[model samples]
Target: MSISPDSTNQRRRLPGSDAPAQAPSGRGLPRHLLGKLATTPTHPAITVGETLLLPLLAVVLGLAFAPQDPLLTQAAFPWPWLVPVVLALRYGPLAGLGGASVLLACWLGLNVGHWDVFPQLYFLGGLILVMLVGEFSSLWQARARRAETLQLYLDQRLEHLVRQHYLLRLSHDQLEQELIARPMSMRDALKELNQAGQDAHGAGPTPQQLLRVLSQFCQLECAAIHPVRDARPQAQPAAILGACDGLKADDPLVQQALRTGQLCHINQAVSAQQDTLYLVAAPLVDLAGDMYGLLVVRDMPFFALQQESLQTMQLLLCYYTDSLSMQRLAQPIVSQVADCPPRFAFELQRLAHMHRETQVPSVVVALEFRPQALKQDLPEQIMRLRRELDEVWPIEGPERQVLAVLMPLGTSGTAEGYVRRLEAWMQHRSQQSLAEAGIFTHVLPLDGAAPLRTVERLRAIAHA
Candidate 1:
């Protein structure tokens, strides 16, 4: 993703500085000199040049103006010490000390006998001042680098999200036209795939059905899906669509996909490829890096091989892998809590996977109502109270009715707003507080903890 230079410069601007924060560009003398003075030097060669240049320039200027006193000892402001101070501010203590050592060398070689008395105080004061300024420079420069790094990361993340959003909107618009021909949106196809995965309590559809769906959505004229064994694509194809030859494990595209664990196509410039067997090679991998299979496409429409189609194919493949993985991941929760709906279990597992990968928190709020509360249709009412983004799973029991609300990308603080909204609704509808209505709330934040423990805790709450 491309970060805008204007935005980056805006972000890089430090307080009290009019010019933008920038690294040394190592260009011509003026820019290079200004950049080095303005920013900390990252290149070792620049540091060496800077350390030597500043001291030598100071000595040359001192010789030109005060030939007898090259150290500028008789000058009003002790100008010779300014070189070390500038070096210190530019590249920290080491460069500053190096500059100071040069001046010290000049004093030892040229002025040791010229001065009747040793100028210990003059050298000591300059050394102390350089060290202090160098220390100060080191701390702030370190802070500036860290800030820039953080800003760069945030900018890249923002760019990625923006691009993804744009693609999502474009796909949605295209899906409208595609629906007339295919009778399915990407969301609908994914839902069907998810349902298929949940069939027979998580056995999922076979590879043949998977390839059929991919052919339908991605317009794969001829393709084969081969099961990967021991991190390698097997020779025999698990599922084949249209005319297909045997699997070529040595295919360049296939090898590229295998090595990178990503989608690779004939158009990629990773290697010089005058000839290739397949048009596209996509690894059926999930966020957890589990390789389910390798999909190699031999033929596709000229128009259908664009970015949208390729991304859709990869997305569907990832969704398929995640669905199968979710089955295994949700098994323990389902086994423990038989009342948990398949959809709820799948979503919980997916959220846990998201949390692990991105550290994005999801919340599960269990609202338990008294047996009498059910008469008011509390579970149903609370179910209606869920946000559009929330997924509600209502569990009914003899003594208590529980409504589990899954809030994706929510935090404890945000969940409180939801609870507050629920409370307000309850007060208006039933004219009673939660305690009076005999409803208790339990919150579980999915913050990288084992999701099984959450299910176990919920099971205990349900039984209690």
Candidate 2:
């Protein structure tokens, strides 16, 4: 059966990555193949001279030793029979009987002058024995050859089944991801928000409208809104309402919400950060997976963390994200690149979360380079290091020099081996250690965060 490589995610090795060849499965050679497979272990050949050499020698010896009298021919000597038996084992029944006939003729010719019943009987008995041996050898070889053929056929079938299995699994994963991309409930929620936005007829901005809903209907005070598309890190302040009026993207509360993709609440009652800013924080992301910003709240004596409040915030934030995505879609393409990071990071974060649930010993490693520009040769270098199951993404800026490598199904040992190779390569290229070259790695779970969060946290650490 024919199989397409794509149908089973055919794995190809990149340059510089070496893998050993697979070992042969079958053990001993089948009997049919053994006779002709090779002349000897070290001297492999199938010359015609070699095949006839022993049989020809046997024939010469038999002729020279033949008796000239009937009395001598009566003795059943086995020397003359050896040639026919050897031929029978190697060339099968036809050659065996033919050789026996030749020996019989030689004996008859040499002893014709003193011919008797004893010589005739002796020739007949030897011919019959040689013929039987030839027939048995021929049948045994045919059966062995057929067995070898059947083994090969079964091995091919097993390979095809394995490919089909991988194809099915890949299809299953794709379907699951599509379902996760946009759930029906999230779609319905966005539809209602779109209807509301149309009815209002641009009476006010969507972000301001969302903020108003949280303050009045949701009973949340000290709230703020930040549009992710217009994110300026710590350079710009988010729109504010109460005590959390000056909260920016750099605030620990907002970072926590963005990192975890959850509504983070600061337990100020414990007084850990005596310089407390916000008490509640949530991120806004649409069903289409576009991230808008954070909704942070602080200093509300009556406000407290509850499941009902968290759910309310989630719905409100999703509506705001939908409104913002529509706004950006109306803008020109050139202005779109600046807005793509958060949305991309958002989607990647969701995928990372899904991957984390599997707990399949995955690892994410970051490679840092100085001057915020990768060398032209770096892509080739990185590709060589990558496996078929890996994902590589550039992070940390418009001029992202920090590369993150996600190794799916990687064990701790695998990670360590990869790191050693990387270090060796780096030392060879730049003659500098990783730290001296402004290169570093942030292995996943080392920072106790998801891959995307770990990247963001790593970026934050680098800047600090």
Candidate 3:
């Protein structure tokens, strides 16, 4: 069922006063602060031991290998400063500062007794020189780290883009293949629609015709079309085909379809329900935006709900409804003359005569109707039942009109079977009665009955 926008309004409203509350119901900490408390920060990559170990190792090697004389300070060639430079580059200014601290401790401990004024000054100058180098190295290494990080980021981004492009291309190709396959179903629907268009007065195809197309082309097992309502199971159905027994129109799926004004799957609409019966219900809306009826389908073949086939079903139903609109807008029926019965019978005879050599089964089904008891949709339903190979004509009398259906290749049994089917269908489809129809109805088998006898049988029913 197609859900209209107003479906939201179907829900019951809660009773309440129209006044604002004095305070908000929710009382708690702000969201950002709560999120901060909920998450833990990641540990720094460089540990304290790693930062101190490199600097301390460099100082121990320099002191143990250097000359004992104060004048031999230049002999170490500032190799200890390499430790500070490396720390500055690898871990920024903090590690550089730590390296500087290690260097001062080694200088003070090794040179404590030998430090004269000039020697101490030399030591101060050396310490200052390495600290300055450490600071400069820290700045340069930070920029290098940033550049390396940026290079990795760009490489990763480019790789992702290439992968995405390939995926999109593949998807496009698949979509093209799907599109190509889609047209086959549409073509079939269009072919049937064109034939329906050629029906009398450019009236569109009938509902049964549309259902037959949908069933055959879409491979559906059961389907129905009825006026759009919160339809209950026990209510009369407008037109039904195939095997859809025990299905309810008031199901949540049906209501959802009605409310949304779009097709809804039975499985999707009621997830809590264990059993899945039908697939979808499509709204048959007229041109004026009112829902003329609903088309409910079930038990389609596996994977039959392809995009193309569903769309074709919708289009064909629209074409069928259009025929009905045209037929409705056409001129009203005029009263028939007294000779109309014989002429109607003659047409049936003419068609039946043509099939005599082939001995194809043929018969006439006459439905007699009293003027006052006729249902408004009775004429349209009768028209809908007419096959392409069949003809329908009105036979008028003093009190009523009889609709005579001519089946050119039908047998007496075929006509008789149709009568039983029609009677049963009418019992569930409407409140119209056989008594209200005011006549007995029977098949006029062109091949089986004698001309005089057939005339007598028709007259007996016509005047009953």
Per-residue CA lDDT of model 2 for 436-457, tens digit only, reads 6566666664222344345555
| Backbone clashes in model 2, listed as residue pairs | 228-292
Error of 1 at 257 (Å): 2.3
Tell how far residue 329 is off in model 3, in angstroms: 3.5
What TM-score goes with each of the models?
Answer: 0.54, 0.28, 0.31
Better of 2 and 3 by lDDT: 3
Best by lDDT: 1
The C-alpha RMSD in Å for every predicted model, in order, reads 11.3, 28.3, 34.3
**Compared with the true structure, what per-residue lDDT tens digits does model 3 show for residues 339-360?**
3333244434443444443344
**Which scores greater on lDDT, model 1 or model 3?**
1
Instruction: Give the residue spans of candidate 1 off by over 4 A.
Output: 1-171, 269-271, 341-364, 370-392, 406-421, 428-430, 436-438, 443-464
Q: Report the candidate with higher TM-score, 1 versus 3.
A: 1
| Candidate 3 lDDT | 0.56
TM-score of 2: 0.28
Q: Please, what are the lDDT tens digits per residue for candidate 1 over residues 275-393?
A: 67998898887545689999999998877766567767776776677567756776777877766765578668767866775566789998988877777777876787777557787
- Against the unseen true structure, what C-alpha lDDT does each candidate score? 0.75, 0.53, 0.56
